[model samples]
Each structure stands twice: as structure tokens, then as C-alpha cells.
Target: MNQCLAKKVSLQILLVDSYDIALNATAQLVKTQYPDGNIISTRTANDAINKIVNWQPDLIIMDIYLPEKLGEIAQTKTGLDFLQQVMQKYPKLNIFVQSPYVKRLVQIKPAIVKHQGGFVIADKNVTSQEMLSIIDGALKGFTRIKGITDIYIYPDIYEKLNLKPEILKLLSLAFNEGLQDKAIAAHICVSERTVRKHWETLQAALGIDCHELRNQGINIRVFTKIRARAAGLID
Candidate 1:
């Protein structure tokens, strides 16, 4: 709840990327969009962290793979590590994360959402207009963007969760598209009863009770979608 975000006044923004061209291009784009905004660009996680501590920017647009040197080592810290540090220190700061690897974004998204701060994730190839739209929405306190959420999937999640492919498919169909059990069964070429059996198995495997989530004021479908993404089944 930064007042600047609500008031739409002059803002401070930090842009962090390893690539010079992308970093400059994004900074220029932000300057064009918010003429009064102060834009600071950095190419390493260490520099970005230093700027975060000293400048305390209102918004940060950063890559997810900033490989930076530490002490004698050539490369030590990662952008995800930087992100965790930033979140721990500035829980309310808005952050926009861009990465070429969609799976990495998916892996980190749940943590970002759990922080309950302003956050958006998009591919590095996102159009300038789309990037601006995402920035505008995030500044207005929108935590999730359709463009990002629609394509998020952590590829290693299923293996990590030890989930069966069949169950994963069912969850993806149901959560991703809001399909009912019967519709899911139709889509998978199975009987509704079979779908129900698989659903029960899946619940046991995930150790999630839909009723409990409902009582916690969580939408079952949305919760399932998060789980699906976490399990790398969103595709």
C-alpha cells in the first residue's frame, strides 16, 4: 500500500538486467511512460541489492537469472536469492520479474504471491505495450496478470511432487480451464465415475481438502490452479 501507487505521482523505479540492450530499452520505455519517474538501471544482483537498500525504489523490474560475482568467486548470487532478500526486507515493494525461462517464473511465482505484495511475472519477449500494461496494473495493486498466469508451469514440479501423469492431466484440465469432473472425463475419454476415483486419489496424493480450503475463504479452482502450476502441470 504505497501512497505513491495510489496517488500516481512521481515514482522511483529500479531496472535490473544482465543484458545492456534490454536494460536500456526497458529504462527508456519506462521513462517514456512515466516522464516524472526516476529510473535506475543495474546489471548485477549485488548492485541491485545495494540500490534497493540505498534508493528504496517504489518499483523494481528485474530478471530472474542475475549471475553475480562474490569475493574470490566469479559468480555466486542468483536473482532468485536477490528477490528473496528484497522480499524479506521490503515486503510491500512492487516487483516485476521477467525471465526467458517460463519454468523458472512458475517456480518462483508462488513465493511472490505468498509475499502478498505487488508482483507480476512475464517473459522477456513481452511486448512493450504488454509490459507497460503489467506495470500499470501492478502499480494499481494487481498481484496477478492473466498474460503471465496463463503460461506458467514449473517443469520439475511433477517429478518433485511424485504425482502421476494421469492425475496431473486431470488436475490441469480441471483447474486450468475450469472444467467439471464430467467434462474432464469427456476430455480425457474416461467415465465420470473414473474421474471421481482419480479425483479422490489426487486429493489423497496432494493431501489437500477442498472443504478446508473453502472454509479458509479460498476458491477451490484457483487453489487447484496454483497447485497445478506448482506441480508443473499447467500446460
Candidate 2:
């Protein structure tokens, strides 16, 4: 290697997160490792996209939920779509998803595997040392998605069951809001029949046994919620 080329590159980190506290905390934590690192922070997907296209940072630490624009409510789909676009365009970009919703990345596991760059995930609540360790691994091209790799549900299973991201939204509505099928349909602007079909699909994907539930005199919906919670599909 040329002597100049062998010199270490200064780390460049881009953080895409709408929340100020998390963004600032993560930036400070990263600075602990690379005191002279360059960090760019963006609060919206559009802003982050522009930065990524122009700057090509060495690594990106982003939340899976972000606003599409300034002053907009942060949304998971918006961030996920942005991430997909980034991955498609920059297959070798190192990425770390820092959020409580890391499980949602399961919907894009196939693409992650196809990516040639470092990819890692950690819940927002992890210790600072753990976060730094994960970041180090990512910069070295390692891949790890916490709470996602240990699950029995694989990407192929998600494909086989057609478990789209919308299913995650449906689960949140059903369990977090305690919404019935009719109410969920109204909220999501879908037909009641479609909501019922989603429930059936979710139940099937969870390997729920309706026969056993009936025999045990348990309400199928309640049992499904319990299973989904245990599976980390819902809070």
C-alpha cells in the first residue's frame, strides 16, 4: 500500500433521527470512539437522502422512524422506504439502526443479506459500550440485528406468509390500541373483510392453532395477541 493510502481515514458518520435527545446522545457516544470524526445530523428522510447523496459518509446511524420533512410527524414507513432506497443505491454503505422498533427490520432482511456493507441493529436502550462495539463491528463489515437473529421466524417464513409491513401496523392497531376488527378497518381505511383476512394471515404466520384454542376455551384473538407479544411483533 502507498504510504499515504495506508494512513487511516477519519470516520464520517451521518445520523438520521427526528428525536433530538437520541440524536445528540448517539453523536456524543460515537465521538467517544472517534474524537475527530465528522458527524452530520438530519431530522428528516429527505434531508438525510440529500446528505447521503452528496457526502457519502462512511457510516450511518439512523432511526427506523423519521419525518419525511421538517416539522412532520415521524413515521416508520417513511424511514424504512428511505432506507430501502439507500440500500438499493449504495450496497456498500455501513448502517446501524438505533431504535426500539428494530424488529421491524425483519421485513427487509433479504435486502440486508444482499447488501455488501456492514449492517447492525441495537435497541435505543442498550449500554454505551455495547453501542460502540456494534459500531466498530459495522465499520469492519460485520452484520448483526439484535432480537431479530434469535427468532425462529426467518425471512423466508415472512415471504411464505406474505407478512408485509402493513401486518406490523395491523398488529400495533389491534394490540396497542385494543381495536376490534371493525375499528381497525375504519382507522386504516380498509374494508372490514380485509381486516379479517389480515387477522387470519397473522394468526397463521404465528402458528396459532384455532382448534387448540377452541378446545381450551380461549378466545382466539386474545391468544393471538399473547403470542404476537411473545414473538416481539408487538409491544
Candidate 3:
């Protein structure tokens, strides 16, 4: 590998884990990819926050089960709250969550989406190569958290968006099943007029205007499908 391009001029990496073995092992693996990296390890959320505020590391590899302070029992909620705080304060910070309870991340899906930085997750049991690859990907601004199917929207906001089940079904049938509007109407036992109405409603709910799309020389259906998928309204 070209050292210059691969290493990115030596990154500042922060490893946050209360376990000495996990922290040291991750730092060693990071050294293999970034030989000249400045790696810092912190065992508690307070120390991690202090290091992050002071050093502003390029990447943060953290565990979900972490303690808030020395001599405190590590809890998933503590780490999660700390992670959320960090993401809020440094919206563009690259974060790599190396944890076994990756599923619990679904709770903060909304904030993750709003983050303008690299956010990647991997199970703690992944192979060294896989973990390194994910870390590399995070450095390159990749957001890949596998098995996370939904992005949580607030209940009131979701209701205000007016995303009804029929609208979601329409999106799935139109995009997933590859059906035309007419065919979608037939499949759902609705009239073509009602199907057209559904399309108009869906477009409005998604904040997509058909006229605006036409003005921009864009395909409305295609754009809608892309937007729906981005919003987690469809597969």
C-alpha cells in the first residue's frame, strides 16, 4: 500500500473502553493500519470526553458498555448517553462503535442520521481484518451500520408527516415490487383516481412536489422511490 494515501498523514485515534485488554488490543490493531497514529485510550466517559475536547481525535473507537467515571460500573446507557452527547457537540466527528450490543443503537438512529460525519458500527467479535476494514471505512466517511432497519422519527413528527400504512404499502409496491401506478392500484383494489391521489399524498408527505421535479427535469417516481428508501419508508 502507498503509505501516504493509506495512512492519511497519521490519524489521531481515541479508544474508549474500560477493559484494559480491549483498549490495548484495539490500539495495536489501529497501529497496523496507521503506523504513525497518535492513539489515546480512556477507560471512562469523563476521561474520554476530556481527551476528545482537548485532542479532537480524527476517529473514536468506543464500546457501548462503558463507565461514567472511575470505580463506577459500566452501563450501556452511560456509553449511549455519552455517545449522543459527543455526536451533538461534534456533529462531524468520525465515530466507530465497537460493541456487542449493536442493536441498542436503534434508539439513537435519528441523531445518527443528522450527524454529518462517519458513523460505523461493528460487533466486538468481528475478525481483526473486518474491524480494521470498518475503521478504515469510517475514516473515509462511510456510514455502515448493518442490521439497523429503522431510523426513528419522533412520534409527533411522524404523525405530522402523515405517513400512513397505505402510503408505505404504495411505496413498497411501486419500488420493491416494481409496479406501475395503474398496476399498484389494481393490486391494492383501488381505483386509478385513488391511486393518483395516493401518489399526490405521498409526494406531499415526503416534501416532494411533482411540478418542482418536472421543472428540474427530474423523474418524479424515481425521485420519490429514492427519497422513500432514504427515509426508511421502504426497503
User: What are the TM-scores, per candidate, against the unseen true structure?
Assistant: 0.58, 0.75, 0.61
Candidate maximizing TM-score? 2
Per-candidate local distance difference test: 0.71, 0.83, 0.81
In model 2, where is the ten-residue run with the lowest total lDDT?
A: 154-163
Q: Rank the candidates by TM-score, best first.
A: 2, 3, 1
Give candidate 3 misplaced runs (Cα > 4 Å): 1-9, 150-235
- lDDT, candidate 3, at 7: 65
lDDT of 1 by residue, 113-201 (tens): 66756887788788999889989877776686444465544333434434444775687578657789889999989899988877666
lDDT of 3 by residue, 31-61 (tens): 9888878999999999999999999999999
TM-score of 3: 0.61
Which stretches of candidate 2 lie above 4 Å from their native place? 1-8, 151-156, 162-201, 214-235
Model 3 lowest lDDT segment of ten: 152-161
Counted clashes in each candidate structure = 0, 0, 0
